[model samples]
Structure formats: C-alpha cells, structure tokens
Target: MQTGENEQALRKIIDFTRLLSIAILIIHFYLRCYHTFYKLKLTHEVVDHILLPLSKTTAFNTMLFAKLSALLLLVVSLMGSKGKRDEKIRAKTIVTYCVTGLLIYFFSSYLISWPWLYMGATSFGYLLFMTGGGLLFRMLKLRLGGDIFNKENETFPQEERLLENEYSINLPAKYQLKGKERDSWINIINPFRGTLIGGSPGAGKSYFIIRHIITQHIRKGFAMLIYDFKYDDLSRIAYNALRQYGGRSFYVINFEKIMHRSNPLEPETMLDITDAMEAARTVMLGLNREWIKKQGDFFVESPINFVTALIWFLKKYKAGKYCTLPHVIELSLVDYKELFAVLSSEPEIEVLINPFISAWRNEAYEQLEGQIASAKISLARLSSPQLYYVLSGNDFSLDINNPDEPKVVCLANNPQKSQVYGAVLSLYVNRINKLVNRKNQQKCSLIFDEFPTIYFNGIDNLIATARSNKVAVTLAVQDYSQLKKDYGREQAEVIMNIVGNIVCGQVTGDTAKQLSERFGKINQQKESVSINSSDTSVSRSTQLDYAIPGSKIAALSSGEFVGMVADDPGNKISLKTFHCEIQNDHDAIQQETAGYSEIPFPSAVTSSQVILNYQRIKEDVKILVDDIVDSL
Candidate 1:
C-alpha cells in the first residue's frame, strides 16, 4: 500500500544514469578543448566508430543532445510514479526542462561547428524521439481511455470492485487539483434512483440537503415534492425562492391553517372506485400493521371489504358531490333499515348487505356487527376534523407533473402535532404516487424528510419506474433498520435496492455495517521480511482489505456525508458543506408565497349540502341498478 521506498529506488537509478551521461559529454568537451595543446587523440576515428551515433564531424552536437534527452526522460519518469509522491509533475518541471533544452542546443552548436551541428540535427532528432516517444505514447494512451482493455490502469467494471479513485468518491479532490476547468454548474446525470439520506440528530443533515442539494435542483427547474415532517422549515425555506428563482408555481398542503385541500380519489389521480377500494384495504391492513409480518386473517379482510364496498357505492354513483371522505363517514352512520333499502337493487354492495340481513333474519348477527365495528373504527380516523378539512374541499389541487411550467408542492406536517397530521401525510404520499405517470418527462424531485413515518404502498414500484419519467426521490431517515422495522425484511430490501444513490451521514448499527460492505474491498500490495543469525529473507504479497471500514463511517463529522450518487455508480462520494452562498433570496421567496395569499380558508359545508350530495348519489345508483337488472 505504501510506495515511498520503491519510488526512491527508481529515482536513484535514473539519477545515476543522467549524471553519468552528462559527465561523459562534459569530459569529452574538456578533452577536445585541451587536445590542441596536448595533441591528445583520445577521441580517435576508432573510438567514434565504436560509438555509432557519435559521428566524428558532429560529435559535440550528438553527445549534447543525448545528455539533454536523458534529463528530459528523467523529468517525465518522475512525474507521478507510485512511491515518490513529491515527484508529481508541476509547473516548475516543465519550465526547467524547456530552459535547459534551449541552453544545451546552443552550447552544443558552439562546441561542434555550426554547419556540422546543423547536419547532425537528424541524429539529435532521433535521440529525442527515442527518449520521449514512449513517455508521450503512454500519456496519450492514458488520456484516450487507455489500451483496448486498459490493463495498466484498469478501472473496475462498476460494482464488482470499489472504484475509490473515481470522482464520485474522490470528489472535490479532483476539483482541488492545480489546474482544472469547470462550467457554470456541475451537472449530475442519470441520478433518478433516489437518494437515501441517513444521519444522526444535530448532524446538520437537513441543512446540507436543503441548502446544497435541494436548492440546486430547484434552481435547475426540477419540480419538487417536499414532505417537511419535522416542521415547515423546508416549505418556508423553499416557498419564495421556488417561484422567484426557479420561475415556477408553488402549492402548499399545509395542516396548520388547512391552507390546501386534496381529494385522493380526485379524477386526476385515476383512482376509481376499485382503486379507492384497494386503498381502503391497504389502509385497514396498515392499521394493524399485521401485513408487515404475514397476510391478515379473515376478520381483518372482511371489515376491509365491507368498507371498500361502501366507498365503492358512493364513488360509483356520485362523480364529485358525495365521493369525499366526509360522505363515506356520513353514509356509514345511516341506519341499516334505510341503508339496505337504498342499496337493495345493487349486487356489488349486496355481498355485505345480505350477510348482515341474513344474520339479523337468523337472530345471530353478533359476528356481522363486530365486523362493521372494526371497519368503522379503522375508517373513523380518516373522518377526523383536521383530516376531513384538508382532504375534503377542492379549493386547490397540486399539478406536479406540468412540464411547461415547473412547480414545487410542499406538504407541511408539523411533527409536534404528528398525531393530528400523520394520516394526512400518509394520504398525500399515496396520492402522489398514484398521480405520477409516464405522460410527462420533466425533471422532478420527491423529498421525504423522516421517511419512515409515512408508508406508501406503491413506493417500491414508483422508484423502479421514476427513471423513465425523469423523477428523482430523496428519502431522509435516521437509520436503515427503521425502514426494515416499518416495512418487513423482504419489502424493505426491495425499497433499498431500487434506490441506488445512497447518501449516508454519520450512522451506527446495521446501517453502518451495510454501507461499509457495499463500498467493497481493494487489492493492496503488502511486504514482510524476516532476519536471523543464519540468514535473511524478504517477500512481497497481495492482500484484500475493505476500502473503508464501518468505524470510519461512524466517525464522519457533521456536514459530511458518504454517498454513492446514481450518476457515478460503483463509487462513493464523501461530501462536506463547502462555503457556498446559495442565492436563497427571502424577498423572492415571499413574492412566490404571496401569489397564493388570496386563497381563503376552506368554508364549512352546510347540512343541506351533505343531504343534497347523498340524495343525488342514491338517485343515480337506483337508476343505474334498475337498468342493469332489466338487462339481466
């Protein structure tokens, strides 16, 4: 792993050769200058014949050129060999070599006759080519992606090996190099698998994500779905900037003022009666959280079906009026005498009605009543005052995928009042997954802070297909085991696998071990030696070791995150909060939020409106069922 000693050996050999070559050229010149007086014949025709390239006529020029070539070769070889780290190429090396070459060319020409030296330029050129060509060829090969296989400096084929040298991991290291170029912005490509941000509390994870990552993406015109679970910090931080700097619309589904409304079954989401029925089933299943272990019993499924059928009947007959969550609770409150009479002709809802009717007719209706009670209790939370307020009215809706005009939709769920807001948060996550489709391919980001708190059933499939839709997802959590606990082992693994870009901050326990293994192992050369009174032995061997251990991950400081960006697979990036002044102008931010200030709080719906909605649905269902029965 260490290279100082080996590089020193190579440097010594090259230095010795350079000095000897220069001495030979210098001593030959000294003898030639004194040969006139001493009448020396040390450089006779026989000696020139032995030295093939040292022709008698252009002797000084050829020798000087050879000496200069030795120095240039040394410069190139010492540029960045394994050991001598300090020998890396620098501005000084090129400057020194250029000046030395020019001086040698002139002095050699003066020593040999100028006319003859000019003739020996051919020999000088050959020497230069022979010395520098291999080095130049090597450099060209490295710059051109190396040889066909690139064995000399092999870059591992993606995930099989940890490419620690890649910019994704060794990032900012590349940026800090002596001379590097950059464009206006750093473009990261193909980063759609979503980023998983995990860090300890007070680790500055939120600040980095919002200030550095989220602000950058929004400025680049990416539509965002920011789920501010901690507070409205993300919403408050991004609201004005989104509209002013990003040139986009801003929508907030705020729970504090009931500032926004969302109908999950809204036609735009494409969740028809059957879809809502399935959603109801999923919700009831999640209430027990039994499905996280194994499939639910008949008792749980029976209640889910009964609720689904009622929701189905309401949504089927009432297009807009009675299909809201409030209506579902209102209809459930009606007496069985009136409810059965109203749904008498419908066969789909008959499944629940006949069972209740038969149990009553037989005077053994305890089981049927208990099922209704279970279903009602689970669905009751959906009709809570705050949830109904936020989910019922259609004062506004989030149009996230609009490509011509980008948008940022912030769903504010204050963690302090999580019990009141958790249901609505889960609803929004589910609804957005239903809304995203392949129709629009604009760049979008779904940022979920405190991700484990909200469980959306379609998240696995959503991440799988987001790349084609050009959507990115960022889920922030405190730990990895939390996901496995929320979603069972099999399902949790699926979710983690789909999110290829993992941005892990200081984490402990299983999360750290998992990431440490993911970084993979590297091949390193190690040396061992043994000495005794009788003999001595030395040997070098290769060993495999973890590139980055779990302890290192656990020791990461605040503002530092080890991430594997999707754009750069097989490599992990360790990023720190650089001193970057993002232009999150508060004035622009206020201007953006002001655009929606005129929207009033959702007005209370009167009893008359509720009755009218129910009457209209009953009338429509009656006519449709009559026609169906007539056809049958």
Candidate 2:
C-alpha cells in the first residue's frame, strides 16, 4: 500500500513538471509577441531569476526562456513516458532523444539575436527535433517476426508494369516489397523472346500462370498453338476462351474423339528436303528420347536419314500427291529392296540412303536391317487406323498465323499414350513452327505443357530467331533434370539460357539453386549480438546474398511465383524481376469454367467406319508397293 501511494505521488509530480514546462513556453511566447507588437519591454525579476540560470549554460543569448522551456519539456516528457502498456523504450531511442534535445536547447540560443525571432526559432527547432527522434525510434524498434533469415530480403518495386500494346500480355500481381504492400503486374513486354515456366506438379503452373497467359493472349488476338499434355485440362480453357472472345478460327487435334484431320507433311509445309529432315529428326527424337544423347550415333543417324529420304520421296513423287505420315509409315514397312530401289531413283534422296544401299548391296543384311529397323519399328507404332485417318487428310493447313484466317489450334495428348503421341505431336509442332516463323504473319503463341515429353528439334534456333517473326513460345516442364534427360544436356542448357522470361514455383534441388543464382544477389544487413557477464554488444554488417534464396523457392506455397520478365525498349521496366503471389479471381474463374461447353466432335465415327478406314490404308499401301514392283 505504501509503495503504490509513492508511485502515484511520483506520477503526479511528473505531470506537474510537464505542465510547468508548457506554461513557461506559453508565457515566453506571449512576452515576445507583446514586445514585437507594442515595442516595449515586458521583462520582470521573476522571469529573469527563473530563466537566466538555465541560459547561463549557453552564454545567455536572446533565446533564453524558449531554450530553457524546450529543455524542460523534453526532460519531463522522457521521464513521464513509460510507453503504452508499460513497454520499456529501447536504450538507443532514449539516448538519441537526450543528445538531440540537449543539442537543440544549447545551439538555438546562439543563432538568434531578436527576442521574438529567437523565441519562435527555438520553439520550431524543438518541434522538428522531437518528430525526427520519434521517427528514428520507430525505425530502430522494428521487430523481425517469423523467419529471421528472411529479414532484409531484397524485393523489387511492385508497380503496375505494362506495355499496353496489342502484342504484349500483362498479368496482375500483388506483393510486399520493401515493407509496403503493393499491387503490380508481371508484364511480358516482349513475349516473342520466349517464356519458360517450371514447377513440380500441383505448383499452380497451369492454374496461376499458364491460364493467364492463355486468356490474355486470346484477348489480344494472337493466333495460338497449345500443346496440352493432359488432354482436356488446358484444351477446355482454350476452347472456352475462344468461344468467349469470338476467335477467328478454332481447331483441336485429338486421337480418341472427333478431331480435325490435317496432314502434318502437307507439301507446302515441307518446302524442301531440309524441312523433311527436321520433321524426321523431331519425330525420332520424340519417340526415343534416349537417342537425343546419341544423336550422331550410326543407328540414330541412319534411321533419321532413312525417314528423311522416305518423306522427301513422297514430297517429290507425283508432286507430293501421296505425302503424309501414313504414306511414309507404309513405305517404311515395304521390302527393303523395293523401298531402297524406289528411293534410289530420286537423286535428291539417293545420297541420304547411300549408306543403307551400300550396306544392303554388300550383303551386310544385319547392318541394313539395324539401320532401317529403328525407323520402321518406330513408325510402325503410329500405323493404327485412327492416326492414319487423322494424318492422311488435309482438312486444314498448319499456317495458324494467316492474316486472313487466324486460328487457335489446341493439340492434346493423353498422358497414358504420351510416348506414342509425342512423336506425332512433335511432327505437328515442328511443322507449325516452320509455318509461323515466316515474316508478315500475324502474332502467334506456341504454349507447350509438359514440354520435355516431346523433343522440339532446333528449339534453340526457334527461340533465337523467332522473335522477329513475332512468335511467342512458352515451355513448361516439371524440372530441369527432365529437360536434361529428354533433350540432352547441351540442348537443354541452350533452351534454358535462350529463354528471356522464367517463372517458377516449388522447384527443388539444382533447379532451385540455378534459379536462385539467376535471381542474383543484393546487399543485406546482418546483425549479431555478443553477451558476457560483464557486457552485451551488438554488431551489424552487410554482405551480398541471394535475393530469393533456394530454400525459399523450394518452400514456396501454391500460387507463389518468382521470376524475371523481358522488357521492350519503347516501354522499359526498371524492376524486371519479381517475388510475388499472382492474384487470381478464384470465384470468377470457377463461375466462368462452370459454364464451359464441351468441344464438339467434328463428325461421329462408328466402329465399322474405324475398321473400314484401317483396311483402306493397308490396301493403299499394298497397291502402291505392287505398282512400284510392276513399274520396275
């Protein structure tokens, strides 16, 4: 009871001291004002005795009473402030206030001569000092909660970045950058440079990032080719977006259901033997990804050259009248002598088959069979009626970027049959790449989901050169190791380096480390404290550190993405990199998708028609073989 009473008495005295300091300042101001207005001395003995003793510390300048009152106010305020909720103020804050207050009290006394001017100046200086000291206290007292290692983590400015051009696609985003919550954008200012999206499964690669790219590109009227590896997942989005936006053209290539029938080897699409070679190489590598590492091996080159010769022969014979993947596959299964003899007649194709022909005539049957069997067996897998019917007809051309008729083509593959379909789909992708890369075409986007499932031959060349053609390529893979395994290390590295934009979520191991390194480093403040029985000390230092550490990337939650985007010269982005959660309207998307209409089949096919189509292709191949033998 006695202690409580003493504490109450002390609080009263502190309050009294504060009031007395304020009263002194008010009295000084009133006297100064009167002297300035009336031009008479208002001095008194009581004022001189009270303020002169305080002024002696600073040579008794004209700012005498104002300086004394400021000092008194500061002292009383500090004494009275136990801080709200009884929280103790930091020692550094208290010391800063003390030093700053004392400096203002003594320094203001020497600066002003007139009583009125000195009084106003000293009072203004004290107000400025208190505000500055409060700001410093807040800064010093900032607390680091949650992860300590994330303290001072670097974050670029999150401003609404956009090119606002017809060719660009911009996405809205939100983030906390430098302690301020900001709403911003992930602007693909020059999307033609290519984009690579990577993450583990369920990391929102399709949900947060790719979906936006699809919808935005469609909105901008880009003729697009989407490789939907999970069949209808992305296909549904493309179909619905097309309907919503009223796209000029829409088509789907699927083996199971009603699909658009188009010849991947349409004569105009494969302009020369080189186009055929590219097609053959893409197909073979897509089928046997292991062979990508052994590209120059005898067996690998032999099969590729053999397939190339067959495609060219079809392209030249009857002016590419019978040129289709089914025709090439059928020709591959014919007797080697008939096949080689027919191929040797064309001088352009003879050179490609000389090695095989030499092996055949020398009675090196084992080598000939080995050379031709690789392509024959692989092509044989794609010989079913469904693929034959699909690849043989020319329902539409691969020129998706045609100005007169821009098209949105979605080529979907079943994960269960990815190995078989990857080769055929790769052929389609390669052909479309050739078609879209011509100058003066409409702007286009080629989005490949599960990109590593198909081997995109000359992908490096495409990424390096296609920007001028306004072709935007987006490749999404689960991991870099998948690219290395499927596309070979050298080419995989080329693809990774050639891309201008990269977005990632929840990737681990070397992928996270590589991305972390790519994000680079920043100067960060690090604090360490040492304590002993005698003393406690804190040391602060700064060093370069990863902007977004690998561990943080590996631990990212769903919808969180870290990436850097390419910018255009006309509209530059000062902060191209980002660590953010791409804001999406979940309810809105759900509502939109909920009303989606299924992609209709082009025409219904019964079991009998499927069988009839299968037999007709076989009969055509046999008749062609017989005609060749009869002509010979």
- By TM-score, the best candidate is 2
Estimate the overall C-alpha local distance difference test score of candidate 1: 0.58
Instruction: Look at candidate 2 and give me any clashing residue pairs.
Output: none
lDDT of each: 0.58, 0.81
| Cα lDDT tens digits for candidate 1, 536-617 | 3446676776545577667767755555555454434333111111123458646754663243344555556544644554
Residue range with the least summed lDDT across 10 consecutive positions in model 2: 80-89
Measure candidate 2: CA RMSD: 11.6
For candidate 1, the 10 contiguous residues with the lowest summed lDDT are: 166-175
Cα deviation at 184, candidate 2, in Å, is 1.6
Off by over 4 Å in 1: 1-188, 285-291, 340-364, 404-406, 525-540, 568-632
- Give the distance in Å from residue 555's predicted Cα in candidate 2 to where it truly belongs: 0.9
Taking every candidate in turn, the Cα RMSD to the unseen true structure, in Å, is: 13.6, 11.6
Write the residue-wise lDDT of candidate 2 on 1-632 in tens digits. Answer: 54988878877886777677666666555543545544566667677577546544442334565556555675656445432221234656656755675576567556545655666666666665665444443333333343465734666565475556787767788888667878888888788999999999989999998888898889889999999999899989988888889856889888877578889999877767899999999888888888989979989999999999989998988788888888888889888778877887789987899999899899999989899898898988888888887888777899999999999998989999999998999999999988899999999999999999887888889989999999999999999998888888898888888999998989999899999999888787676655555544456788998888999899988988898888887878878778888888999999988999999887886767767877777777677677777887
lDDT of candidate 2 at residue 75, scale 0 to 100: 64
